[model samples]
Target chain A: MSQSTVPARGAARTSGTVRIVGAGLLGASIGHALTALGVDVVLSDTSPAQLRLAVDYGAGRPARGDDEPRLVVVAVPPDVVAQVIEQELADHPDAVVTDVASVKLEPLHALRARGVDLTHYIGSHPLAGRERGGAISARADIFIGRPWVVCRDAETSSADLAVVEGLALDLGATPLEMDPEEHDHSVALVSHVPQLVASLLAGRFVTAPEGSLRLAGPGVRDTTRIAASAPELWVQILGSNAEPVVEILDVLATDLAAVADALRHPDAPGARRTVADSIRRGNEGVERLPGKHGQNRRFAQIVVMVDDTPGQLGRLFGELGDLDVNVEDLRLEHSPGAQFGLAEISVVPSVVHGAVDGLTARGWKIASMPND
Target chain B: MSQSTVPARGAARTSGTVRIVGAGLLGASIGHALTALGVDVVLSDTSPAQLRLAVDYGAGRPARGDDEPRLVVVAVPPDVVAQVIEQELADHPDAVVTDVASVKLEPLHALRARGVDLTHYIGSHPLAGRERGGAISARADIFIGRPWVVCRDAETSSADLAVVEGLALDLGATPLEMDPEEHDHSVALVSHVPQLVASLLAGRFVTAPEGSLRLAGPGVRDTTRIAASAPELWVQILGSNAEPVVEILDVLATDLAAVADALRHPDAPGARRTVADSIRRGNEGVERLPGKHGQNRRFAQIVVMVDDTPGQLGRLFGELGDLDVNVEDLRLEHSPGAQFGLAEISVVPSVVHGAVDGLTARGWKIASMPND
Candidate 1:
């Protein structure tokens, strides 16, 4: 079914009301975005305050009657996402429903084994979020341009897919259709595994001596930034996506073992080869990544200095644009001495030389480019 | 000795010169930075064109007399870095010298075993570079505000340390003192291991079916950007830093195994715990990283969109400054659609809400914050 076949405004009549079961970040945000588009949204939450906050935030109005909505989006904590989805399916049999959860396969399988109505329900995960949570944080364009993966099973009706896809488009997001297994596996590699690696690295420093962490720099930050996410939330995500995530981590472990053995004895030529092989592999991995706008496939570096002032760095970027150098990537390092900061700018190799020269000529001191 | 006691400009000493043998990217860049600071620098390279290019680039002039410079920096491909450092040291006695190779312990041991003058020699590596190579790519500020690590040993003299530190300082870099072993180990964890992981992930796609890579996004790019580096250069670096790198990879591998197992059997409770543990650990690791400018550590997510217009982004940032939000970190995702891009803005969480509201109120469409 095309989007035009659905109601143009205030929710689709055929689907009844669109009831948002939880008033948290995802649910409330969805309500807000949909409401802004003039959809009839009714929000229900266990917490009266949260529900009111959702309404206040313009996500939706409180449910006034027992009338079942055509669609119910269950957006709760991951551990509870499956339960909420299951409960909603039971509570409102006629409503075509879905979820916005990180992990999908297990939830789908659980519902399948329990023989929940598969035609009216689909699984979805909008690959977006922040460190903060709640309805107050909701925005209308939250999913804009992000990938919203829809997990479709054999029993999923064409109408179900259309509803989810329409929702994605409504929020300015792209819909990516995939099987539950593929979705789980892909996220395991990209999201779950990476999150674990970051957390493991970050955890190492929790027990470190004082000065040791003082030396931690941008690399560590880049590697572990995701680790700073809410622990309870992650537990839910990892718990649901355990299998695929573990598989990738296992592969990493095997590689890690080889590397460790080599490090213990570098005199052996084979050890050197092992180490070189790994680094080479990493180099290759980095290259496969798409460049800015998915144009070039090479990674660029951005380096700049941070000053003590509150907004000095922000202004520096403003200046960079005046120079017309498109920065592909950036990393920052603050020097030990007072009053100095360093920002690394990674751009296309084609523009690196010019950007360096331009920035230097503009009177902004360039920090780490090689000197000939 | 305090920096104040060191002569602001060492008397234009006629003392023996520092012979930089390779005149390639690392060699020439070092020479250029040094020459700009009035250090007596002599440039040499196997390629005459490269030698001339070094001169044109202002790295240094050819050595005029037979007198060996007080220091010799052998900046060559990793495969030849050790050989070149040995050759240069053999050619220059009574001169304090160092090699700016990425890996350290091996070369230091190699020199020791070969009976090179240890008293005047140290193993040093400046944690800096670009994907491009050669003299033309060099910049005088290559090491400025970057870490120039001096790997010391019993043979390394205080004077040698001072000289290397001076070079780093003059180049506007931070001089870090470390034992050769410690330096190798630290870099293995921070640099070499990351390189390998990136490569391995990228290599998975080197043989990917056609068009599969076109769908690659920022996650892949961020993970694989370092893969585009010169392969031969990395071979040498990994070869030298093999032992420690391998060791770290082993630890990582163990973590990977646990993750893999969890993925393979999601229903198993232990698997869930393992995944959660990994993520938690990553969170801890991320927190250990030092904040920019030695300030309170906080993370900022920057969101922005790129329009097809050449400088539309430039204008957006130019306007950002007027709103008074300090952008601590920024990431832009390129989508295929016309007239739209995805920009994620990370600022101090304390101010991110205000910034988002400010941007939205200004009619700039903002992506939903993660929590939202």
Candidate 2:
């Protein structure tokens, strides 16, 4: 087996090398980030074209010597991530290896079944992605600030865990230690199921009359944004995490039925109550949500008349810094005739009104005052 | 009976005055936009304080000299919108009177039953609002670029339609002519039902275990943002548009049930097919939605490592403009290390790779690339 000697722990870790297999988006990105940090990176890919693309993107040079690198990251499709990781382990017995797949349980199970060296293999899934794939799409900063879920069981060696965690740290991502099952279940609810819901909502418009679709606005766009995701990737995700995703869908179905019942029987005494109850529940759910970066969700709106002049709207937002109101949402509409524009700014609500009044008193023509 | 001489048809039309009966959010905003356009605006409200607030915000002066305004807008709570419109019609016989209520058919039917002069009464609903209410929240440009559904029946006169359309135009809103029934049905599917659905989803989080709520991000926030709206207003809207809203909900419920059945029996081939079908349908729905404004929906993720320094992240966005990549979405995650931050920039997929490469070449260290 290929081998290399490096300083043991406690010596200020100097430049070391990593071998990235499968020069795809994840692998190339890792190589790019590591290389930027003065780490020597050698990348290997089955496709010479992809390897060249990764190298061209500054991910790393093509693998050179038979010397074993300290780490190997197998960044391939979910179906092949496990196999590649196993192959890498057998090919380089000394290197700690990990796979950056979306799903963790199946890969971990595969390794367990194959009786791979428990100490060198760690399973990880970074909760981040884009719609496009391939080496050409790779970027160094993809993992920064996102959660890198590392699945560890009793068999996972502390040294391997440290290596994976160090890699996550190097990439500027939060390393979250979680059980494989828990990670799958959480994603099924927050990511997979929601994607289905968005897709379902968007699908309705596909068959809508032409005029009907033209009238569609930001609301529909926001709801169905995630529906544009890669279907093949989603199929694999939903297939593997089918149980939990289905469970969440079941809950959504029940809730939807209750709402339908309430709407159907509006004239009944309980109709209004049912509708209100559902709305109230929604309010509670919204309140439970964490705001930006774990902050409390702030709500606000700003209404300003937009002139037809180019860059006029941009200037308005720039001036908002004077108000110190964090704009959380915004909507703009122009009057039909020769008139000024109207822009509604939604912020944290705490300072939105004050900002409106401030701008109004400052010779900025206010559109409307707060109703209350 | 109050009467005024009508300006000669096709004569240089005199500037039309807008009379807002209640200086609430909608009323004050209408008055504000009209007054800003140098049109005569007269404001009135049961609460002198509210009326005074509207006037102070330059919405309009009080009605004067038994003057007959060309148009009267009844902007009040849903429960009173119809009554107020009827009263305004009685007081101003020559004015084209309309109501800005969320529900249309009920108010239109109520006026018809009251034997009000249908020739002069038009029903309109401005599909725009905020969670906050009152003149304090009113803005002149609130309706700009938003659809303002104007409902007309056989009894509506051309002159009346012209006046109402002019008012909508003056407010910088797109005037959509629809039958009252059709308007109600469309809104029930797109607006009212979605509100209820959001509320129901949000409610589920209210009783969730501690820390569960913290997991909510943009998805839940976006889905339930409207849920924070006034419950009482929704009650009136849902009650009035119960029929069509219920119909849509019923269909949704049927689909939901099918999905639920699929989830419950995942092992069964038929069940699996149903589940897949539902997901596929959802995907189709998502694809039909128009991108932001009229643009195609493009998604890109840029991972940038940020330091603790304030405004460093802001500079990155500013630099993105230099690269000529439009950022459509953004998310940030701070790792455990105190010194670094990761800002993920999601742009149109077409430009994501270029942007990432440009930034990396510029010497800003890259983090992790998003998995495709």
Q: Model 2 Cα displacement at A4 (Å)?
A: 30
Q: Please, what are the lDDT tens digits per residue for candidate 2 over residues A215-248? A: 4555555555666666666666666666777777
TM-score of each: 0.82, 0.79
Model 1: per-residue Cα lDDT over A1-372, one tens digit each: 123322345553223468988898889988877876687889999899999988976788998767668788888877676678878888888777889888888777777788766677888888767555788767665566667888777877887778888888777667788777777776766666666666665565665544445444455445555666677787777777776666566666666666666657777779767766766666555554444523633745545545556776667777778778666545455554535556766565667677777777766655455332
DockQ of candidates 1 onward, in order?
0.37, 0.31
lDDT string, candidate 1, B73-103, tens digits: 7787666766787776677776667888887
Instruction: Report how large a share of the reference interface contacts model 1 reproduces.
Output: 0.47
Worst 10 residues of 2 chain B by lDDT: B1-10
Which 10-residue window of candidate 1 chain A scores lowest in summed lDDT? Answer: A1-10
i-RMS for every candidate: 5.3, 7.4
